[model samples]
Target: MYTTRNSSSSCTQGGFNLGVMHIGAPACGMNAAVRSFVRNCIYRGDTVYGIHDGIDGLVEGNIQEMTWAEVTGWVGQGGAFLGTKRTLPEKHLDQVAARLREYKLHSLMIVGGFEAYHALLQMYEARGKYPEFCIPMVVIPSTISNNVPGSDFSLGCDTALNEITEICDRIRQSAQGTKRRVFVVETMGGYCGYLATLAGLAGGADAAYIFEEQFGIQELQLDVYHMAAKMAEGVQRGLVLRNEKANENYTTDFIFRVYSEEGKGIFSCRKNVLGHMQQGGSPSVFDRNMGTKMAAKAVTWLTDQMLAHRREDGSVFCDEASTAVLLGLQRRSYVFQPVIELKCQTDWDRRIPLNQWWLKLRPLLRILAKHEAAYHEEGITVKEVEEALD
Candidate 1:
């Protein structure tokens, strides 16, 4: 016998009823958005339910009903008031189907990322097997990596980027009075550089190291040493940005050696790599405002929007990118603009900071090249020489 947990809450507005279930990780920022939405729904006299531990809870008949007051003020909180889990009910499809049928859930607001997508797709695929498993699901991509292909940005990216920039700003200020200091500040980016690149631009770093651009350690060392030499001469301040996707210890140690050799005081902003505390802070003002707006829209979409779908693999797939994803509207379009305002066309005057820094250190590059006859002795390519100079 398998058991699952689920939550249920109901509200009525204008003689119409509404019900919702939340299923996703609390750390990913969907919880706050969903909580905000739930509160709004209750204010508007709509019903809602919290599915504890995500879809797994939905499969086991473990459910608790909730009300607006139960989830109030959660908009500012970090973790989900309704919990989450990754367990898929595919193994026990029948049990899951039976539970869904019994619960008579009206709509499920899945507050998760790719995993949630897959889970919902699977659940929908199996829905035909059970007569009782029929409900509309709206998916909210809430991953920190901000790589949900269709959505412009994941739910939590704005808040995460803001926090990263705040940290970088504080660190930059703290570096004042320190000569030749090179801090390799690391930020989270599992498989995407959106966060790192945006943070670097917003934080005004001298250089941004991201997975999108493969950076060799040897080149980084030479570059740091060159920068340190310049800083020692007169340039008192500089910033080196690092994305966590790359090797953390290796990069930090390499940059630290350059600063240590120059006798410059170096300090990195202390942070928990796992980021539990960082993830738990109150949502930023932007997030709160956006969250409120998104929640209200969600109620409208579920009630009035005719969600379109397409057939795939002999089955119908709801347009995840269009219907479910909540990329905030910008100028009447659903898009999340990058934190760093990017110019598609390059301006010589606005070259990337790394390129600008390299230009500043061109004289040093020439000085270092005088000792090595790589162009003549090794017949190195122009690209190699350019890279070496950088």
Candidate 2:
């Protein structure tokens, strides 16, 4: 059953009835985005509807009118205030359109990740079948995995990275206190390794195993040998960051065994799986501010569409096909692009290519990790190297 957070009186005095929902995995800063959108809508004299449990609520006709006063102090809150679900809207297209009409929603603000965008694409394709589904929508990428395409950074990524880095820092401290110790920390990133890679880079990990880089027994052996060699050089402690899905053949247990057992007592290994803990935490200032910024942009775009549909007597003339856009930060700049562009061919394993900048940034992370001091000695700062890489 779908549920509403805070119910209010019907919003009959409406300029534009905007609906908002959070789909996919729950992440920090989701509430912030919701608050920002609601505030923007209210400021513009538009009515806002909070769809509970994401698209499922819309399908079930579960929604509530939201006002700015109710969502105060939600910017620092974690998780989705209106709730969320993994279900896609495409499966319930007819019901979704009916609910949209029932609530008189002119535009929808989807706060979620890759699956949300895919749902948007499906809705686009199903437009001809369900003419009432022509409501304009905007997607705000908010995932801890940071795997959403067309964006350099997604909301909740910084907060999640901070959590992972803090945990890795404590593990590193423990490794330092113990002789011949190596800490194998597993981080959450699904098939993408953005979280693992960034955590390793930020936490000073000796090595990181991510899905972007192929990993097998040969590669694991080399990493083990490298850590052993570093230990022999009196490094005392070594940290290895491993993405949860880095390799199908290699598990965290297997890696620990190879280091502790196969290394012949050279190092005492421990594994710390930073699982869902990475997804829970108060959002960082960066995430709060970024969420507000992105949400504001989405509201602005939505308002523009509403204005375009406005009639002479203040009634909004619903259009034939609504514009669907994905708000993202591409190359450190805010940009909105059609959600259809995010769709691409996937392989047998369901692996799709990520942003090109992320692909380039992956190798640079390794270079910066290994040769920061060497480059510094040559009057080449890490910032310069990063610029060159970019």
Candidate 3:
């Protein structure tokens, strides 16, 4: 077992040094989160270090002290300014710990999604073997997937949704003009269907194929038949929103092929993969505001932990336990949750349930898309029952 000396005591003599890095896929508003965190730390009289190239940088000991002017006006920026990597830190724990000590960074603020959190949890669990793993940390979820557990919304989700909705709207317009085309728009979500589901609802997609809904060949056949029936009923131009990894057996091309072949007389088909575009574009107002709020809270939390480590005898104890937390927006309120509770073995197997209210939107969207008349009739039936009871 490797042991780390209590070197953080030196940070108490001067202001504590904090580190920031981005990891996992690049998402809009990451720079905004970094900017806000850097500004807040500076404002609070702390030194901020930029970990270039994420955890890989830490392993390589590539670090640079950051100043406020360097990160000014970055709230609207898209992608990560610090540069992000998909590398896991578990393989390089010793080097990462050594780099932290070399820079004397007391805490590190991670700005990314699932993979980043997993790395943080791994480090926390390894604290017994590698005492340097005891460094306090904070994670700000910034994935377009919106799949991070324990949060209603992740940073950059709104911006990505906005982009997807806009692209779908344009595609719908083109389909409408053709008057006999069904546009299939494939979106990014990996296994989480939150993006596809919500974008379909907001974009008025005729149907959505999401991971949350277990889809099969039979379901696909039925969906195609229903879409053809809708076309026969004078509905022209349909939009289908699909999660990229929704169904392993069915690909976007396969879906388009089916629609083109089966709906021959009723409609033609076109496929559009919105690939990385969803991850680009300026951060939306929601993202900007959320990033700022979350980043500031993270800085404050880290600073408080540093102060708490001060001994009454004027000596600083670097070995003092620090909280490792994730800052998230839970039900319209900001929450600082323990990272241990948020840990999961796999992204697909979420530890916390996704927003149930948002999940409810999935079925509601389906009803709005394919069963509007039945929905309206059901509403009327409920109204009639209420009147009879009255």
Candidate 4:
């Protein structure tokens, strides 16, 4: 982890209480957002604290003020300015809260994934005791997984997709020699398939497989056989995209065995895990501008609000946790709000063919009942569901 707290400094007007704490590592594209935020804060004459190593750092009193000069030219950089850890507030909630009170922080801005949101809930639970310490938190979704709810695109997803496509494109180039080739490209995102799905589409994969679309072994075999047949007829190459988290190991074993039996001349596959590599490169123009814009919005919201005080001194005490704000693009503007959840249900079976006959004709009664229940819960339409599952 990188520590920048020693280089941090802040300017404050006497009797004014304002500070900000950031918790989380730079594994994703959060570093760009944090640096942009510091620039915006210092430019507006606001005093903020850079707490190293997130919640644990705060509890250990590893706090320092950030200066504009220290955070400039960091908008395009990846990772975080201040170091981050997976520490939870519940571990030492009392000590962490005490540190916030000591710093007299006005608000906090947490940039990370779901773990960061859980920290925000902890801070919200500490209201009504320190009115001067009331801190408003704003979260910027920075995970490559793009699993956060309320936002269509998170900060690091574009970078991750680009990374996967670049790797696959190179692999595709190499596999174009003499024999027919098959390549399996794997991507991160333990629970979500956003990266896999989009990467597959962008990479021009012949077939895309993801946990978001659960497929059975039988169907997978058929798809491979069909692709191999296409290659045998001089197609030369094929692309198979797989989601790492969904069943990478299983899919790889099954494909290799089936391809060998089909006399495809011992077909080969490549596995590319764009892990932390997705977090470090230079930020694209879109990410840099978006980071600055979001930072400005967060600052303005914190400064303009007339929040209630819980202490006798009438100082608005801010909590030391981050809150998630959903900002979705609509038309020509960004709609910022809170989101409840993001749906992630896989319902694909290869055993049953997805032909028109199966989809338009007979439907299983049990499956239909299950579909009704899922629809009531997910707001999805019946036609959108698979015949076997509906």
Best by lDDT: 3
Per-model C-alpha RMSD: 11.1, 6.3, 6.3, 9.7
Decreasing TM-score order of the candidates: 2, 3, 4, 1
TM-score winner between 3 and 4, please give it.
Answer: 3
TM match of model 1 to true structure: 0.67
Q: What digit string (tens of lDDT, one per residue) describes model 2 on residues 1-390?
A: 111122122223347889899888888888889999998789778889999998888888779999779898999999888888889876688788788778877888999877777777777777777765566778888899887776778889899999999888877776555678888888987888888787877888877888777767866676677777777877787788888888887887888788787667677888888889998679999999999988887877777766676668654444343377778787557877776666652221533334434554554655645634322323555675576465
The total number of steric clashes, by the backbone 3 Å criterion, in model 1 comes to 15
- Over the stretch 143-185, how does candidate 1's per-residue lDDT look in tens digits? 6555444345566667788887787777767777754355566
Prediction-by-prediction clash tally: 15, 0, 0, 18
- Which pairs in model 3 have colliding backbones? none
Model 3 lDDT-worst window of ten: 1-10
List per-prediction Cα lDDT, in the order shown: 0.52, 0.76, 0.77, 0.57
- Predicted candidate 4 versus true structure: per-residue lDDT over 204-240, tens digit per residue: 6666556645667765666666666666666766776
CA lDDT of 5 in candidate 1?
20
Question: Which residues of candidate 2, in runs, are more than 4 Å off?
Answer: 1-14, 311-322, 345-353, 368-389
Q: Which residue pairs in model 2 clash with each other?
A: none
What's the true lDDT of residue 41 in model 4? Answer: 69
lDDT per residue (tens digit) for residues 324-349 in model 3: 67777776577777667665423446
Question: What TM-score fits each model?
Answer: 0.67, 0.88, 0.88, 0.75
